[model samples]
Target: MSLDGHTAVPPESSIPPMPGFPPRAGIPTQHAAPPGGTPGFDVTGWVSAKRHRTPPAIFSLGPEPRPSDPKTLADDAIPGWKLILRAALNFLVALEIFMWLTGGALVWALGFVWPALIKAAGQEEFWATTLLNLLYVPVALILVFVFGRMGRWKAVWRRYGSPAWSRLRGVAVPTAGPVRGPVEPVDVWGPLRVVADPGTLALLDAETAQGLVGDVDHQRLLGALERVRQEPERLAALLGAVREHGAVACAHPSGARDLPGRSLAHDLLSRQLRLGAAENVPKNPAGYRGADIALDPLLLGTSLLAVGPAGSGKTTRLTRPVAEALCLQALTGSAVVVVVGAADADLGPAAWYDVVVAPGDPQAGYGLDLFGGAAHADEAAARLADALLPDELALRTESARLALQQIVGPFESGYGRLPGVRELVLLLRGEEQAWAGLLAAVRGSGMLDRHQHELAQRERMHGLADDPGTLLADRLALLDRPVFAGCFNPSAGDRAPLPLFALRALDHPLRVRIALPDHSHPEAARILARLAVGQFLHAAASRADRSLFAGLVVDDASAAVDTHAVRGLQRLRAANAGAVLGLRTLVDLPESLRAPLFGAVGGRMAFPGLAPWDGKLFEEAWGTVWVDERDVTRSLDTSGGVVRRSFRGMRALLEGERAQTESVTTRKVERRRWSASDLAQVLPRGHAVVSLTSVDGTQVPPLLVRLP
Candidate 1:
């Protein structure tokens, strides 16, 4: 099976050659709009000859099957069609001899028209030929001009013009002019050769045809070649017969004959979250625009989702470019980034960031403050409780919440700040009080109610005194790892302290990296990521000024659920912050969280590797799309159970009344403007069906964007 999941047909999968070409069914076509066009792909042998496959030899076709010796047709009793036709041909041969002699008598038989034949041959004069050429030139011009007005010109040429003729002849038509223009530049990825039949060519507008004609990057070059509902017939009619590079296109077009790549850095709009200009920039189907990474400064408040399986190139194509662009922004002092990714993931231009926290990096000494910013004791306790607990620990939420409030209140009452994670861990363990001030503050400031409250829960919690702490301790173990030694508790280790909320106050632009080693301790990484995000949200919520732009990025979000996920996903907009959350599959999210989490993000990218259920999410996300449907019926005539279709086909039929098996078939067929299953499992690599909310709140349809 190829990338599109069809083993039978290749590109030009849909509108197969109007009735007389090779069979191609259930193939994929590039119909772009986007939010992007589906990038070109061929996992099967249809686009090109497969090296491992040897096509069967054609032994029974053409006129070569004619001939039989008729000595019983072939020297013996084994008879054939020749045995029956030989006698019939004998009489025809006699009649042919009589007519052969009559051919020379054509001049005598039509003496009256002899002069007319000679006149056409130019036997009259050179003057006569010259006169006709001059007169006919003017007459032919007039005839062409008159016919051009009727639409007959367009309709007729659609069937017989360059595009159509090229298809009919089974060859690609050269697009360059006969006379040379300036030398054309070549693209680095090399040239792409596409062979599309005329019907497919008919559906393409000139600009699009030009993009397909030129050699560009796979993302930009092939993305512009997508076909949609308006040209369903033409899309299916086209076939990509020749493929030598990463891209493929139409074999013929009626419009712009040459396609050229655009310059991204200089020609693009010079503002927020912009990447490269779109391929064939002006998107058709009107309102479905392209380019502009859809990462608006105002809208980052809503968020983004980039998903695909490992090796699907989400990092290279989608993540990398966006990261580099954001890095550039950070360098300009406009935004702050808190990016958490796999340890080895490359974030461009390291100098742009002020902080880099790599787990297991002993020398860096970085860990979030854990409870850095809280308006009061209750809020801090609530946030900590949520972050430290998981859904599996349902019984612990309220108890842990009450216990955390007790722990933080005493620490804050004494030290004037919330306790660090390491301190919280020790206090939960009931260790001897190392800080005499905590004991002193608790006893002296105790109003009668405070003392009674602390004692009341002690007996009620006695039986489960260590349960909640132990469970949370396991998840927080990474904080004490050698890499984060000095970072977790300022007093516990001799190294410099690194804090999560420290950057929230920075007036200048800053880049922050939180490295999670997915390749090694994925679970630990996930838990840490969740804690950091929850802290960031708390920090964002308390800001006196929400003017500063901030982004929190989590790659592989499906791995774990942090405390702030629900509010952070849906309500971060008020904090003037946006998030980019990456997930491999939606199934990883709990059922209760899935719906709201999806609804919260204003922009989405559904890449390959999603299951049908996942694809259905996109369908719902994209909502309904109106598509053109064609019902095709195919019939197979079986003569004596041997299927055949020809003038003499009746000869093979069983003569008597008989029972026979039925032979015929027919059938029926979203946001990628395809079925959900196709978008989920069959979407080619490095591509996504994107639905983004424009600044105006216009809900654009999901568009195919070949990732760059």
Candidate 2:
């Protein structure tokens, strides 16, 4: 037996026994043996012997079956005459009903007022009324006919339009058996049938010739095939005739002489041929790794992540891709590429990137340098006190002056007073030398120390004056452009609050990359992450319509970040900004940041990680298919060799694998890579993975680069 045109023989066990066969006590009974034979027959051995004895050969079924003409099949299936009659009947019935209603109402009213009408008709007024009433019949009849035709037309079109549209649209439909019209139209007969004229056949053949062989008029072709299937011999003859005519037409040069109607069939056939050829044509150009590596022009418009370990060639990947994108954009005159780095030393030369941002560069000033200013301010204040008060009377100065002296003591111990202090005092006192007397009195009275102390305390307390000069310089720099500020330490202390510069520079979306060491101090990293996220959110809120002035790249992010910063990052996305984060282990991700960041990122790129936990985290964060265990294994190989040498002998062993006495086999285990790539292609160093959160979702990939 065959199923769907394929051989399908049943297994021996599936074959049923004969109806009259008796059951055996122990042995399983399959088919009943031929008369008088043993009940249990060994068919397998027989089959095997036959298989060994015979060689398989390709079998040819006869020539392909010819198909019936599509026109004849359609004519046989459709009840054309019945459809026309139904339409005409519907029209008459509707007209009759309309006439009855209007004519009946008019007659009813006339009956009651006939005497009055007759009296009025003797005059001209009644005649006008009669004329108007008579006009209603024809108008009513017209409306009925129009409405009835529309209703029937809708129904008829619905039935025919589906197949016609599918055919025109090139959609495939199944062909099972002979086509048939509506069952209700069984008694109906068709009137429209034309004789098989050469001209008619030529026209149809020409049209069929125009279309490519595989370019089916889906519904029409399916219907035609179905009809032909019902009568094989008739279909075969029709196809043979069509083929013969087509060959003759092709062979005769004179046949191509443009016969007006005859060309239609050829045109259609030609179209079908072209469409078929097109369908078979390959769309993609040929290439190998180069093709795979070629950057998509579309991807240039989107953000990318290049990630690997320190020495894993992340920089190479990023530089080339980014440079390519920038070059492409420049060539196309589309957009400018701006790269902001922590410092000029970090990013290298300006020529390295389209728009390079380095620390201290005026064009990339993010905000005031809090620490730099504090150091400068301490020096200036100390110099001022040293010049105003004499050393001999310094102890006797006022409480405020003494306090100021103590504040300046640290600066004096660190760096000696500046010579400009005397010049400054002279300016304040309005005398070159006479001011020395006032200074002496104030120093002896302790007032100078007291004043200085108070001023120093105030500067430190305000955080602005401690490094006023540096602060001024940084703020002045920030006024120029956006900066990628790096806060090495983030805490509540004076230096800890340095991220405020990022908050201030939010107006200018600068790209900020923060690197934190992976050690015991996770809390510090968490705090910094929160600060970065908050700064981004604040910026996004301020510039709702513009792209975020800055983004945060936190390497080795911890759960602590989600505690406060994740909320901010989410808000930034809502406002149309972008944020990319990095994490080493998903096992440690804070739930709050995990869900939102993972959910919102537009794309995800995952690298090999330690266990199912990593995969699960990504799956939970972003709906991605779990990579095959084998593929993951192939992608991540971190095992290393250890060699030990002794006086007697030397031995080498592979890490993470145990040797057995008889054989070697490894226990299946989740693999992990030290580093991974993010969507943006920014590689992280050490045993780090890059996680990016954009308007899309979070992606974590193992770094392919080596760690420092």
Candidate 3:
């Protein structure tokens, strides 16, 4: 990159641009900076290949077994001496305010009465007043100590003090605007802070920390200091590191979304973090205001749900950024990103990921074994059947599941292996001589009675186009399509290896894309999606040990959600996995899954076009709290002349009646924290209400965010 941050790349680049983020103007196709150019420990050993660095602490070379128990770090606490000093300082301030008020009142009273008293006392009175004034200085000094500071003033102030004054509008007063320069993402001195575990902090390699430092010349150093106004954490680090290394160090932190596109790759590839601020808003520190648009991964037992209209920026703004971040994570050995419906182009570039499995792209040559993934043959069969099940066959889910198990059971016994799509289709159609062998094996194995009923039912349905041929053709159309012709056709010749369900892949840091044909064959796309999602969930749970952070990014989730997804929704986090699911609204989900799915995700962003029922789901999932607000109203009216109105009022009073002349009213009102209607249609374009969950399971108030 040049000092101005424009990237360099070759013209005939194979790397594709992200969906919404086509290569920006002047952003040449390019490769990322070398691993040594970034601040992170090497994680090359963790991945299948030495693609990148930045390994997890426990994942590095160590005989120490990974600890299963969670660790907690104690919060920073104010020392007793500091607390005492704070109290003393507060007391002195109160004493000063009291003395000023008392002095002002006494001066005003004396000025009023001095002339009358002086006249009454004459010359002797004047002398006496002069003597009294001479004594005032000593008296006031003693009173200042006795009544203001060392007396019951503290108690008195406490009894009448309005703590709300600081919070009241027009009293404490807000800043004219956001600070002109940078502010902390979160304050070091803020009351609420999550103490990061020592292990987490130790992940930072001090030797390579300099890579995180950027353009630290005198001018840049001054510029960075000018921007870092209140981040004590960063300030201390820079100062300490500079002292330790005998070199001044500083990093440019962008205040807005003005960072060059390549800068994103720097943060991601650095391995210190998976996300960086794509765009930023100015800070308002007094209140928890402004946007924290950091691209945080939904892993570590958390997930993200972004709901918005079809054309809304949920994909461009939310999903794309997250997918990009996960791709970086996958490179750094921190995450395994399994994205469905998106190819190298849909996300960022193929080089960003270690693997790209495009099922429909014939050139990609990635095939999926229809039944080899699950720990049990039963589950594998069930998931494949569910994916192949027709949308209209709602009542036949069980029957389809049974038919799959029967076919799978006989074939596995006969062939001693799970069948690919082609082989399974041939066997189910009863055209292959292998079917006779499979049936004989099932009967010999004494499973024939259990499978006969379902097999008969399937045969009866096979005669109909809606059940058998449609199911076959729906997927077969994708297989037959010009784009995916030879890739999935095992019967045609040789087959590429299908690695979708490999358990070892879970712990392996790699980016895999399950690209589907969504536009041409929607049902076929849905079928592939359901199967992929289910397998990811089941494979995640089957991991022998918790190691890598796995993530699934589904951009068109409305079509993919199924029974397995619902079952895996809440459990994925525990399995050391996360998913970013996108859809129009909760209305698209089944009623039973709606609430659970919403509750399972740790992050939710509701953009415009939220329906009423969807709003209710968000409302209930986010829950509600009673907030008190003053409801003020005013009225203006023409009334009778002053005397006439007064006479009528007096007469009514004498007659024990009421007169109406009220114009203003103020009353305290309680309402829901965020009403259903607030999300349904009230939010403006580019604005959304979000609910974020902390690692400790704390629910934050629905945050109002302006999408960047």
RMSD of each: 21.1, 39.5, 16.3
Model 3's alpha-carbon lDDT is: 0.51
The TM-score between candidate 2 and the true structure equals 0.26
The TM-score values for the models, in the order shown, are: 0.56, 0.26, 0.56
lDDT of each: 0.48, 0.31, 0.51
Q: Model 3 off-target regions past 4 Å?
A: 1-287, 291-300, 342-345, 432-434, 437-482, 492-504, 633-668
Better by lDDT, candidate 2 or 1? 1
Superposition TM-score, candidate 3 onto the true structure? 0.56
lDDT of 3 by residue, 570-605 (tens): 777677777888888776776767777776688777
Best by lDDT: 3
| Model 2 spans > 4 angstroms off | 1-530, 544-560, 609-611, 620-708
Per-residue lDDT over 249-310 for candidate 2, one digit per residue giving the tens place of the 0 to 100 score: 11100111111111101111111000000000011111110011112222221123322233
Residue 78 shift from truth in candidate 3, angstroms: 39
